[model samples]
Target: MRSGPYKIIIGLALWLITPVETFAQSILRDAETEAFLHESSDPIFRAAGLTPQSVHMYLLHENSINAFVTGGQNIFIHSGLILAADDVTEFLGVMAHETCHIACGHRLRRGEAYANAGTASILSMVLGAAAILAGGTDAGMGIMMAGQSVAQGQFLAYTRGQESEADLAGAKYLETVGINGEGMIRFFDKLRDQEILAQVRQDPYVRSHPLNRVRILQLQQAVETSPSYQKPPNPALEEKFQRLKAKLMGYLYEPRRTLRKYPPSDTSIAARYARVYAYHKSLEWDLALTEAKALVESEPQNPYFYEIMGQILFENGRVRESLPVFKQAVDLGPREPLIATAYGQAMVSLEDPDLMEKAIPILEDATRQDSGNTFAWFNLAKAYAWSGRDAEASLATAERFYSAGVPMMAVMHAQRAMESFKMGTSEWLRAQDILYVSQEAAEKLEKQRRRQERQRRLSFED
Candidate 1:
């Protein structure tokens, strides 16, 4: 499973309920979603009056067009919505709403509410609607609770008010960021319409969020009430958004669907972007390359176009060509950690030791640029080890996996630290307290996993 704080418990439960092969497929993609999440959290946090310094986001490989806050820190975005959104503004709107929950202390407030609800009332509710929301049958509820420990149902049920507040605050943040608050209204409206078209089979974001005339009116009010707002003239960033959206759409939808949705267009680059990803996904190497080459020709100065070039080349096993394309991409958007990571990887693959050395500082800079990036941490660790910096390499590798939400890696490295201390060598063990805590966490998770397995088997017998 992907290295997420919630994964250890969720993974075991999902594993029991889902067939093994299905779960494995999801686990692989979940890792990338987690990485995208780390990359995207900062702006949402900053927009919602929270600190990006410690915030973490994880993308869940759920197909439902919904999102939820599982705990105090983790915001889970559905992969479906991530792929379907029209642009980053739309994606950020979803994130900003969730961020509002964190900023306003919703998790803390939910705990208070759950306590006030008392044990029996919480259990009754959990056995009722919570079971439905969680796909837990009446009997399954007991097994589910055994793993969750806390009242997971109560936590979600009690957060309805918090979700509402988040919508309001998120809209305000969108305005602050100079995003058209209409994006929120539009997106919500789309979801509301979708629920209606599906005859309300969808979950109650529609029912709870009720897209009454008042909702859009309030969003408009928030947008107008905020200080004078105007989206900055950023064609470059907008192009990046388009490209990312296109790539995601291609990956998410069938080729025929993508072609239909993004039909060829000369005025808007969306279609061209879509074609690149669609052809690439189909493994039509010649077609994808042809489309990409044309795009680069049409937009010669657009650095994002070079990013697509680098992606195409690398993905098609042209690592040698990918390196130079990635360099051009970095020149175009040095702040983008994804492009920099790609460049660094290409350098590493070619065994250009000096280039890889150069790439380390660059990758390190990328990690610092987005301290939450697990990918950067992983790359930096590998570069360090290959360059003969064992101590820092271990620490970096541990930290990399640690930030990605995998406490196991943290615990593993913590053990390494303990070993170094035993040797009375490796100056890296100077600060071992955090490592000690990680060790305890890993043990706790192992215990939970064992407990969950017992429950699953017992339930199966029943």
Candidate 2:
């Protein structure tokens, strides 16, 4: 309470901000995976005195072994990192560490360092030029090299300090949550081998996280000395972790590879869940349907199984069948926005007047539940359009584009929506707000583009 916590922005830009080094990974959405991540990380967030909802976590379809927090409370995790984790504990360890970075204000501190680093680099070039004028070319080059070395040293030293701080803080959070730091240390051990590899070959996690031998040893010693380290593992949690990994493996790997790993002989729940996707992806519709049916039969109450069945059936041209399956999923997990969005989308695809009318309320509820979901917003726009609410559709489209960071498109739609609504009305005001915000964002992007263009021209001249 003593700390002044800035308001967390809930929108597309924050959720899908630039990756670590402008991470190019695409954002992946899944209802089940998101639920799993929140369930695992919520306790750690609470223990760290942070609200789980205030901190948004996004899954990236990235193969690099990385997880990083950016734009304050946003954490982007790579799929490779999850698959690389041997178990849930290891994955949670990374989550705790990233959360600790937010708790400790590392992002703000790092931002300060970056600003200073740029100034130092520019100052060094000037000093280097002065040396060249006073002495010779060699002397100037040497001055520049030394200056850069000092600048780089300062940044790396500060980063290492923060990394060490987060490591200890993460360990404390784990202990507070009654989870042992053994998994934390084990994950570190897994990455320790990367130290021997050449820098270019190192995983993004190792590169960005910067794990020195001393820090690793200190972390290991601290975790081992803590009483929580002796705590027994949770079998139920481990089972969930296994299934989470299995699902990722099925989705990430080739169908051939997944089938090989979870062959016909394998009848475990994990294998069954994985083969459902593998068979679906590999175009073996019958096998996929069979596996999905088996899963639903085994866990009649599980909403996710119904979701998968609905998706498989819908994608395979069994639209009517999928409608009921998707509806079942919604009935079971009514609060799940993504599932509801899917059901709404399926209803829209049918183009039936009755179905479209029904979809309007469902899509509206989905968007109301999670306004940041672009998919839901898009579906809602379609439903609104079908219901002869063209202005509402335009407003919804504006909202969708705004949340997707497409400011120009948002501005265009917002303006159109504004034209249709009377002044002083809520819809008109909202349209005006969207138009203003999106126009500003669009202008900012244009300015950046111009600046980058100027830089390129200068580089060409040099």
Candidate 3:
């Protein structure tokens, strides 16, 4: 039941501190992590009266602990925050806070305020320049100061107010969802001293989120007053969180570091998950397969375990062996677009015309379920190409590029697709949509390029 690919940020200036380029490039996508996050945040979203399916959550590749809401219903969580959380509750608390931000319309209101402030600031600057030219230095200085005050007030004061509101609302949401709100208090307490740290050393959360002793006290009081304040942690949720952390650590950390972190002595499921990835990363395919098989045996019904096994085998050119494992994973997690995509990918790898026919339908379904998955679109294109569905293949290629953030390429392929399909056909209409969006993306990229060029020229002039 995947909704769609996240709306790529592109040149959106959502965060004041984070540059548009940095924000766009820092996004990381993984099926397992996304699924886990959705599972964890679903309750908080529900409590906030938001449809969990409509809210897209993304993981930022940054190592600094941070989370923020932007672009309406999107929440971006840094990988460092996930790794740093002591338990599932802490992570859930963060999710609750971010969800509350979205539910409260904080970002939208803040964005409007900022936009208005920016307009005022520009007008003031114009007046200030006119005053200076007229030899009224005092008036110019006063006008400039007023402009700065407006910008600063909008940026800092408005955001701080929003932060406080999100904290209160988030705690209430967690309580309403039957989750302990104390986790929010504890997480803030852990970072309370961070306010005193040097800006360079401070976590992104500390910089972006205004926190204080009073705010912490307020959260504590809220938790104390809530009836669900002392709710026990769910074991299933804890296990899933641990496995997610292990998976992230294994994939992101150095192989040596991952192996050392989860040694042979640690025989837990999380340990096994980490080691499997570590072995795979180190190119020890045999060892990785052995660990993956052990995991499948331990959790026979766990689709993720089977996914790891299939991945190891498929990546090592054991397509025949990988096929059944992928199928099993899909059968267990039919609704998971990633698993279904993987199964389709395995079928495509067989390169048989008959297999391509089967792969096409599976991949089409997978892409339909999760339109943001570039890999699924890629494999779908391959299947289509093999089956001589040239127009569909071209359209799929366009979609894959679009999801991967290559707008010019997407536009080119989409145009090619347009030529292959009959006018007013569904395929032709899809290509038209892709072309329209991709052209807009191309324009955005060009504007960004011009801005960068202007900045560079100004820097050189200075």
Candidate 4:
């Protein structure tokens, strides 16, 4: 199943009942959507005096309206928030706020407090060690609750202060970039009503950010006072935003809902995009093909239209037919890592020796451009294995596993890679690095197991 451009691998039974933490296990990794997010956030990041490329954006598979900055330069945004946003500016406003948290070193300061309270080490252990060992057991729940209690109690006030600071800082960034700060105010205003709801019913953003009427008023005042308050929205940007939202709706929502929202009466490109996804999801391949071909005809130069068509054809068991479409997308968007990755993936899927050889360099280049791309690494591994490059294939598998946070598997593949490579070579050294990290992860897991066991024994005695 898919949700708003993200593939959901968990079974429907598990997916329906899974908690938020379990949902975090899935990640959405579309190249085009990620690229668009980066572009939208670049101005805000730059205005905050941070390099645009320094912070990485991750779209979580969950459907909660929230975005958060963690211990590192990673920003996680839920696809629900994206779909919920009214416009590009509204979404960008959220990005600006998260970037403010990172730029202001709020996470670092909080970490320092955690360290002072002797919770930092255990917190890290909870994420890596306890998570690996306990899975969803009571021990795991206790550990997580302990960490959250400490974090919430010790830093709640500080975090609220930071939220206000981020709001002001984000408005300043939008102003500096000539974007209307009203969008930020408007988004917050929309959430203001959520403050009155029960805690469990409130959106995650409301719960995390601590929204209030006073804050909304202050934000509105600040935005109205900004010189760029009346600036018009960029037409091109708005178009991209519309297309992205449509694409996501088509992929994520139920086919019936999608078709209802974008009926046959709606002939706009965005409407067509949604219908194509709906048709594809409904297994109406003929209708999907017709809509996709129409999209291609309407926007011959748009790489995304071709990309979507290629994806539909490829997924529907038309490998040979999909190749030319994917190539066209790559040719149109040469610098696009996602398009290149898709082309390479298609080639690797062909299982032809010559095609696999051709795919390797493309996959390699795509991975080089975006090292965080799991799809590229996985396909690159397939390409390598097909060409009988066992050592390289093992290394690529290790990379894929490492990126997916499966350090044990990563270590296994790294060990295999080491056996295939000569001593003192670059590949051997890289394998050694993977082995070292994975071993550290293993040790952490063991520590967490011992800690949980001791706790369980103590409880039993009591």
Mind giving the per-residue lDDT tens digits that candidate 3 earns over 163-243? 788888999888887888878888888888899988668776776677899888878888889898788778888898998
lDDT of each: 0.57, 0.73, 0.72, 0.72
- Candidate 2 residue runs with Cα over 4 Å from true position: 1-23, 108-158
Flag regions of model 3 displaced more than 4 Å: 1-26, 108-158
Q: What is the per-residue lDDT of model 4 for residues 1-462, given as tens digits with 9 covering 90 to 100?
A: 223433321111011111124222344556567678887888889999998876767565456687776534557677788888888788888888888888998843345545544443356434633432422122222233334333232332236678888998999999899898777777888888898898778776776677777777777788889898877677778777887788778777899999999998998888998898888778898898888889999989988788878887787888789899989988998887878887887788889999999999889998787664556788899889888899999999887766555568879999999999999999999888878876775576567667878878988999
- TM-score for all models, in order of appearance: 0.67, 0.84, 0.83, 0.85
lDDT of 3 at 216: 84
What candidate 4 gets wrong by more than 4 Å, as runs, is 1-25, 108-158, 453-462
Clashes of 1: 0
TM-score attained by model 1:
0.67
What's the C-alpha lDDT at position 132 in model 1? Answer: 25
Sorted by TM-score (best first), the order is 4, 2, 3, 1
Tens-place lDDT digits, model 1, residues 1-462: 233432222211011112112232131122223344555556657877677755645343455565655434555455566666776666777777778777887653345545654444344333323332322121122222332222222245334556567778988777665665555666776776554556347543443233555555666677666563344423554555565566556655677888887876543576777777677667787777777778778888765677677767776778788888878878877776656766776677666678768879888877766554555667787788788877667777666544443456666775665554444544355326436544554565466567668878988999
Q: What is the C-alpha RMSD of each candidate to the true structure, in Å?
A: 8.9, 11.3, 10.5, 6.0
Q: Model 4 — which ten-residue stretch has the worst lDDT?
A: 9-18
lDDT of each residue in 225-316, candidate 2, tens digit only? 78788786567777777887778777767889998989979988789888887777677888988888888998999888898888777778
